[model samples]
Structures are given as structure tokens and as C-alpha cells.
Target: MAEAAAKQRSPATPRPVRCIVKLGGAAITNKGELESIDERSLRSACAQLRQAMSGSGDAAPGKVMGMDWSRRPGDPADPAVDTDGFRGMAGLGIDTNFIVVHGAGSFGHFQASRSGVHKGGLHTPLVKAGFVATRISVTSLNQEVVRALAREGIPSIGLSPFACGWSTQQRKLVSANASQIIQSLHAGFVPVLHGDGVLDELLACTILSGDVIIRHLAQLLSPKYVVFLTDVQGVYDRPPTDSNAVLLREIEVDDNGGWSVVKPVLQGNKRGVETSVAAHDTTGGMETKILEAAAIARLGVDVYITKVGTDHSLRALKGDVDTSTDDWLGTVIRSAK
Candidate 1:
């Protein structure tokens, strides 16, 4: 009788609702400052993340999309409210399984530049020291992120690529086991992954960009949605700061298996260089992000490139507005119908 009662109390195995959220460096950190995190932005992003995971069917009014949370502090509607007293969408009868991957931003980039870690292959002792420092820096940022999520009553564990990944001499992901990640989700905790300095067969050690990590995890997890929250609204026809630039609302490979016009922007210029990438950033910035998004979209996952620190894109991702309709604000990438 006791055993039967325990069985009755056991939580049902959650249905996998595979979703991946990536917070870009520029949106979460002050890239020009060495190792500085934008706490307000981090908090805002985490808030939206929690809301997204809550399985809430309704979107807050679009007017509140980018509303400044810091200024409002204890607003009851604040997504950062602790779950103890605040009921979430899960309690409203929905379940969600999510994974989060965040970029290194100022944490590792400047140190990696000074250390020459991106150059690949073994270098002088100074360069070797940079690899160690880069690891330490990114790990530090990961700890802070987990702590912030905890403040909001979100359970998460940080997974470092350096600890659980291997790359070939060509930097291909040779072997990576994400069994622990799957276990975490089943246990009802969000698994967080980040870009870090990882050992390389020929390079000794190198920076693995978070964007690359997202694509790798998406391929392994086959999430239904891949949401990329960046500093900008979405991919622009030209540089966003340009007077004539307009956001590309959607991008998809054509029926002929051809690329979108946005492909050239994702690939950057003839030199394969992007001006928006921080001077010290060794990882490809917006360019690589778009390229990875396109690749993952072709794999049948809906990919979204949208602004961080806002609810508009997050809501769009959850089907608040039919992406099939023009009401969706962010760019959606999918295989051409």
C-alpha cells in the first residue's frame, strides 16, 4: 500500500518540448570592458527566459516589450519574481524542457586576445597562460549567470565545453557526450552551456564559439525552436546603424536549395570580416551567428534572431503571433516550404 502511494505521488515523465535559447555576448556584456557583465541586461534576459520556460500561453502587451526592468524593481508583473509566492505558467498546466547557451562576451575575449588563444597550435608560455586565463574568465561568468537564475528560482547547471568536449585538428567536434544534459532536463533542471577554451588535437587549445556550441547542441537535441537573443532586432539588409538599413523579417533556403539574400550578410564581406565584432573578439560575431542559425534552420528547427532584454521576440518564439503572419517582429529562419 505504501509503495502504491509513492508511485501515485511520483511526477510523470515530462514530455520533451525541446527548446534552445542563446543570449548573445553583445546583449549580455559590455564587450569593451575587460570581464564586465551587464547585470541589468543579464537579469532582464533571465526574466524573459523564465517566462518563456513557464509555458505561459499569453504574451504581455507588445508595448512592454523592451520596458526597463531595473527602473521598476518590485513590479508584481516582473518576471524576475521568485517562484515561491509567484505561480508560473507550469502551475497553470503546461510543461517545458529548455537548454540555455550563452556567449563569452567580455569575460574571455580580451584575455584570449592578449593570450593569442585563437591563433591555434602551441605558442610561447605567455600564450599558454592565456588559454588558462580564458577558461577561468568564462567559468566565472557562468557561475554568475547560474546565481542570477537561482535568484529568480530557476534551477540550472552549467556545462562547459572544455570539460565535456573534444575537437579534431580541423576543429571539428570529434566527440561530445550530452547524456548528463538529457538527465538534467528529465530531472527538471535547465542545463546551461557556454563557449570556452577547449583542448584541440593540433592547436593545443582554442576558443570554441558559443554559436558553434548552439548548433552542435541543436543537432544533438533536435530542439523544436532555437532562439537567438542579440543586441539588434534581427538581421538587417545592411548594417543596422546605417540610415537605409531594414531588418530582414525572414530568411530561408529556397526550394532549389539556394540561400537567401541575407546569406551574403551572414558570410560578411569579401574579406569575411564583420565591423560589429568587438576588436578583441576572436570568435566570429554576428556573421557566424547568422550562418549557424541558417544551418540549424535547414535541419528543420525553427530559428529566431531577435533582440535580447525584450519580450517581443520571446513571445513570438512561443507562437504568441503566427510567424506565418506578418505580425511577428523578429526574423524567422526555416526550411523553405
Candidate 2:
């Protein structure tokens, strides 16, 4: 009788499906390390995120910023903490449960590749150098993001991407104790995950890029939504550059569906990045993001790809939208029956 009473008296817990928002590197920061970071664009994204989190049924968004943290021996953190991180999202009646996962935009991506120190990927001898570069770069970004969140009364932490315990054997996460994520969610905490060189069972190498991380997370956390802020508004029928390119508002992920490979709309520092045109060099690009998102969407999660500048990001979270942009916001590749 006592046990039954306790069970009945227990408050019904709200099982909120997790939320995954993957901000592309090009969207958040400038391309090359030699180039400058875009403070204005970053601020815009932060503001919208803040607004969305304060939205109805949204509560405070668990925030995470993942990056490749690295630094030269005596480098100080980026002095100008702009309006990008979650802390910048505050004051809009939104408190981000912040999690940050950033990439190694300048640090390892260039150095390792150039040095050829890391012959291939994770197992490369230059891995130590790569990890060093990744750590410094990622760590710096983490601190700034954390500091911003902390100032806003939102607790934040810098967790390593590799430490998340995800395997790339089948190109998906096979093991991870969801308890940590569960606890964080219950407490309204945001866990951030970014791409890093991880041990891959199939390729016998290391895979880097936040794209992989987002997919693994979707499968594990079963988030309610996966928002990828692609460089463009959404997918286009033809190459966006092709004067006749039409923006595809929505897509159904059938075995054979509608999605064409157009020239990449996103551009890095034009004067830099030898691999700038190397489409497959990076993690999942627009196509991969679409396919991955579609697969997860099949699991009943709504996925959206929108320009970081538009209101679609906020509207999508609200669960209703009428996209009116021509640049393309995003396309939902619905799963095949």
C-alpha cells in the first residue's frame, strides 16, 4: 500500500524530446584562421536562438558550442567576446541551457593537412600535433562560450567531442550512457558536441566534423528536432548559382527523391584554403546533412535546414512555418515508406 501510494504521488515527469541545433562553421565563423570572424552574423544567430528558447513549450534551450580548441604557446583567448555565444542570447527572456561544440576551423584543419604530419586521419602520426592544435583551438572557443553562458546565469561546461564515447564503426553511435544526457535534460542543461578526429572502426581513421556528431546524437538522444543552419536558406532544385535554380521548400526522402547537387553556395576565405573547393574533404556537407537529417526525420523527428539569418530557425522551433525566402531555407527529406 505504501509503495503504490508513493508511485501514485510521484509527479509525472515531462519527457521532452531533445533538441539538436548544428550551426555550420561557415555560418558561425569566417573560413580561414587568417581571416576575421564575422561578429555581426554571429550576433544575429545568437539573438534568434535566445528568442526561440524563450518561446512557448520551449523553455530554456540546453545550449552547447563545440569547436576545435587550440592555441600557440602564449596566445591569449580571443579578447573580443562578441554577441555570438548563449550569453549573448540572454536579456530576451531566454536562458539557454547552453552546450557548445565548435570545430577546428583554423587550428588543425589547415596545419595538420598542410604539414601532412597526420598522414591520413585519426591514426596519423601527426595526430598528436593535430590533437594539440584541435585542443587549443577548441578549448579557446569553449571558454568564451562558457563565459558568456555563465554571465547570463546559465551553467555551462566544455566537454570534449571524443569523450562522448561514440564509435564510427557503422557510421553511427553504438554506445553511450544516455544517463548523462537524461540528467542534463531533466535539469534543463544543454550538452554541446562538436566534430573531432575520432577512432573509426570501418575506415581505420579519424572522422572530424560536427555533422557526424549531430547524427550520432540524434540517434541516441531522440531529439525533437535537428536544425542545421546551412549556408543557404534551404535546398534548391538546381544549382543555386544556376540562374534558374528553384528553392525546394520541402522534400520527401523516398528511395528516389528530389534533391540535386548544385555548386556549393558557401565560400570560405577566397584568398585562402587550398581545399576550399574540395567538396568531400569536410564532414557531411549539404547533401550529407540532408540525408542524415532525413534518416532521423524518419524516426519522427522534424529536421530543418535554414539560413542562420532568417526567422525560420525560430519559427521551425515553434513547429509552424511558411518559408518565403528565395535563397532557400531548408528542405525536409521525408523517409520512404
Candidate 3:
């Protein structure tokens, strides 16, 4: 009788499908501009995410339904945090839990380059100042992201790595707590994290990439999906800028966690494509992204690398693979395991 009573009294836990979505720097900000954010792109991405999460398809015709950015926590305009429109799986009914991580783009990259944060730890006063500036830049961007999500009626709170994360002296993320994220998710709020300068065990201070953070979070949180929103269509046979480059629709990691590339039709004269870091991007660019995706895929997580500012992001989130058709979308990186 006692055991039966204990079982009956226990509250049922909500088993929501968890997902991690990254807003790439290049997609959301003009890398050429210092600390400049593309408001239109940001807003559109947020709205699409809102639509996907709500599963309502109830966006206002020709306009998205969201709160004004100026609304505060207690304001009437602010919707209840837990009262989202997401109806979940129609047949089995499961809520969706989203965690957002964003890149620094122009904000941190310019400052990182100026400070040489990736070279090693901070030593000189000048380099230390640059580190501080980089943190400030990324933090400011975080605020804008949170505000945008709020306007889209997504309950989100900014979580800064500078405050809660630490890295090895070599700048590898060694330790951190997911309690905040866990608590926020439990309360139906999205926890937003960004790439930022972190204290290094060996160097003093160094830069941490959002991609790295995603890998760490995936291992800890075990999200079902990891979606990367970038400026390009997807992984390409070569850099899409090349005259002969073509989009690679999918990538599969072998049981040994190795990548198997699915080549697309060539656009021009066939040539080897190199994934090099961009001029201003301090973080390793396409190369790092693919490597990170591969690393996470090894852990049994589905990874999507899609272009932002398009319907590709939504398609990836929905697990829709239309690449064989004319309506082909982003690259889906899957694990052999």
C-alpha cells in the first residue's frame, strides 16, 4: 500500500524533445561592420523559430506575432513564460525545449583579432584590455538576441560564458555547470549562451567558440538535435564562392566517428575546395564547424548545418530531407551509430 501510494503521488515529468540552435555570426551580423547586428535577419530568424516551437503556424498574415522589445518582465505585454502555443506532437504530444547559443561575429571577432585571444592566454595589459572589450562586445550582442527572442514571445534569459564557464589554460572548456540551463528549461524558459572570452588555466584568458560550447552542452544535456545557422546554403564540395563549387547535401559519420561526404553536382570547373578561416573571423570558420558537428554526431546527436535568412532552418528543425528534390535544403550530418 505504501509503495502504491508513493507511485501514485509522484508527479509525471514532462519529457520534452530537447534541441540546441546556434545563430552563426556571419548570418546574423555583417562581419565587415564593427558590432553591427542585422536587425531584419535577427527578427526573421526569431520569428521562424517561434513558429517552429509553437507548432501553431498561427503567425499573423504578413506579420509575425511577437511582443514589443520594450516590454519588461512584469509588463502586460509580456506573455506568461510557460504559456507557449506549442501543441507538440499531435499524436503523442511532447513539448519542445530549445537552448540557444550564438556566435560573436563582428562583435567579438574584430576585438578578438585585435587582442589575439586565440593565440594564447592574456599577458600584456593591452591584450587584457582587448579581452575585456571582446567580452563587452559579445555581451552586448547577447542582449540584442535576448530582446529579439522576447519580441518573438520566446521566454529567454542570457547566460554568459564569461560568468559561468571556464577553460583549460589551452582554452578548452574544462568545467561548467548546467544547473541554470536545467532550471530554466524546467520552468519553460530558453537559456541563451554565446561565444565569449574565458579564463584559461594555462594562458590566463582565451577565446571560446560557440561551436565548442555546443559540443560541451550536447554531451552534458544530450539534446536530440544540434542546428547550426550559417550564411551559406550548407556544406559545399568547395567554398560556394568558387565558380565550380556545389552544395554537399548530407554528411554521415562512420561508427568510428569519421565523416562520409555526399558530393553534390559541380557548378563550374571541378576543383578542390578549401574550408579556410575568413579574413576577419578569428574563430576557425567552416572547418571548425564541420569538425564540431562531427564530434557531436559521435555522441548520437543529429546535426544540421543550414543557411539562415531562409526556410532551410525550419526544414532542418523539422527533420525534413528534401535534398533529392528541387526544394533541397541544408546539410544534415548524421552519426552511423
Candidate 4:
């Protein structure tokens, strides 16, 4: 009987994810303010997420219109959707096996930067204090995000990277328990993770950026695709603030993770595009985001970067946007031949 009980208690295998959506910190929070959330943008994002995840049978009022699930020619074959779990529900528009990751904008960045938490040296009183303060702030934001998703009738549970034993060595992630995330997916809950202060083998403690988290998750989960919802339309040839800055519609990434703009015929190194990081953002900002997106693309998973709360974001998340047309107003990073 004990053996039988043990067998019954065996962990279920994790389901393959349809996609992973990353909510940029700056898009959902007032980066200039201390711990201020952009309620309007957050609400809009949650609503669109509901629409994208809802099925045709759902009575939800703002169901997404004109979503085509069929893959386009030259596009990678869609990942197999699991048919025996929560995703197996009939009439579902898109597979329910997905993950949401968010950054720490005004929530924790100010405290972290002030305390120099990302610089390590936790043996110092300042670093230790900053670590604790940073966690408190970021986790507070996580709760708000979970509450917002819950309000939209989405089953979301906050998962902190620090709580999951995610640690780094010399600013590079070396250990993380992907099992926690997988188990959450297996149990039919959308795991909502956020950037947080984590232990570092060398530095003692450091800040793990959400962009890096997304890259690590993509490597472990191998989702069909990844979406980054940001404040801008997409990656640009120059700073978006510049009048002459042009949005690069599509970026082709080679196996080695090098990328180049395939649209509008841009010259010079796209990676060198000028971008401004927030004064309080300890993370590398746009440069890190693009680099991580390219890394994900190198793994054969397409990455979409678009403005949050836009139709393009919704379509990109649903994997039904027509990328060949000029109507697509986002940048798609895909593996080149």
C-alpha cells in the first residue's frame, strides 16, 4: 500500500509551453516614481491577456477577433500542444501552457540601485540591507501583478526567483530550479515570475534582470516562442526619441546568436544602437533585452518585441500575426538559415 501510494504521488511530467510573455517593467510601472504602477497599462495588458488565452466558448466580452491559428508559409511549425491537461479543454483558442515574467521597474530598482545590491559584497551591511529591501519591494509588485491577473479570471501565482534558489556566479546565472516553474505549469497555474535579488557564488548577492530570466526560461522550457511587451513599438535603428529613428521590422539571428536587420536596409552594427538606461536601472536595459532575445532565437524559438497594450502585442502573443505584411508593427527575431 505504501508503494502504491508512492506511485500515485509521482510528479506529473511538465507540459510544453505554447509561449512565454514578458511584461517590461517600464511598460507597466512609472519608472520615474518610487514603486508606482501604471494602473491603466497594467489593466489593459491583463485584459488583452485574457482575450488571448480565452477560448471561443468563453463568454468573455472582448474575445479576440480574427485570430488565425494556422501557421504561415516559411514559419516554423507550431509546437505540439498538450491535449491531456488544462490545455486539453475544448474550444480553447490557444494552449493554456504559458508563463509570464515581469521586470522590477520602479518597484525595486530604486532601492536596489541606491543600496548597490547588484554589485554583490553582501558581507557589507549596506548590501545585505539593500538585498532585503529589494526583495520586499519586488515581491510587493509581484503580488499586485498576481492580483491583477486574478481579477481578469486568470490563474496566476507569483514565483520569485530568489525563493526558487536561482543564483548567479560573477553576474551569470549558474543555478535555478526550473522544476518549480515546470510543476506549476503541470498543475495548470500560470507561473508569474519577477526579477529579484539573488545569491551569487562570487558576489554574495546580485540582481537578476527579468530579461536574463526570460532567456534562461526559454532555454529550459523551449517554448514555441517568446514575447516581450515594452514601451516602444520595437527595436529601432537609433534611439526611439530621435526623429530619424526607424523601427526594424524583422531581425534575422544566426546560429551563433549574431543578428542583423533584414528590413529597411540599415547599416552599421545594430547591436550598437544607442539606448538610454534609467538612472535607477542596474540592469543593462535595452541592450540586454535584445541580446537575450537573440539568444532565445538561436535556440530556434522566435521572439517578438512590441509595445504593450497594442493589438500587435495581442496578435504576437497568440502566434497568429501576419509577419510578411507591412501591417505587422513589431520586430520578430528568428533563426537564420
lDDT of 3 by residue, 1-337 (tens): 2232233321444334368999999888987889899888888788777767766554453333343446555676744443243343232122338889999888988888887876764678778888888889999999999989877767888999778654555776665556666677777778899998888887787888899888877776667788898888877766576765656666767656456654443344222332232211123498788888888887788898888868778776655556567575777787765
Q: Give the TM-score of candidate 2.
A: 0.66
Query: Model 2, range 67-104, lDDT digits (tens) per residue?
Result: 22335347777533344783566443444443344444
The global C-alpha lDDT for each of the candidates, from Candidate 1 onward, is: 0.68, 0.52, 0.72, 0.78
Give the TM-score comparing model 3 with the true structure, all chains together. Answer: 0.80
Model 4: clashing residue pairs? none
User: Which stretches of model 1 miss by more than 4 angstroms?
Assistant: 1-17, 58-96, 254-257, 261-284, 317-321
Error of 2 at 103 (Å): 4.8
List the lowest-lDDT window of 10 residues for candidate 2. 269-278
Error of 3 at 262 (Å): 3.3
Q: Write the per-residue lDDT of candidate 1 for residues 186-275, one digit (tens) a residue.
A: 777778888888877777777888888787777666788888887777777667776766666666654343446433244343222223
Residue 297 C-alpha lDDT in model 2:
67
Ranked by TM-score, the better of candidates 1 and 2 is 1
User: TM-scores across all candidates?
Assistant: 0.77, 0.66, 0.80, 0.82
Candidate 2, position 203, lDDT: 51
Q: Model 4 off-target regions past 4 Å? A: 1-12, 55-95, 267-284
True-structure lDDT of candidate 3:
0.72
Measured with C-alpha atoms, the lDDT of residue 246 in candidate 4 is 80
lDDT of 2 at 179: 50
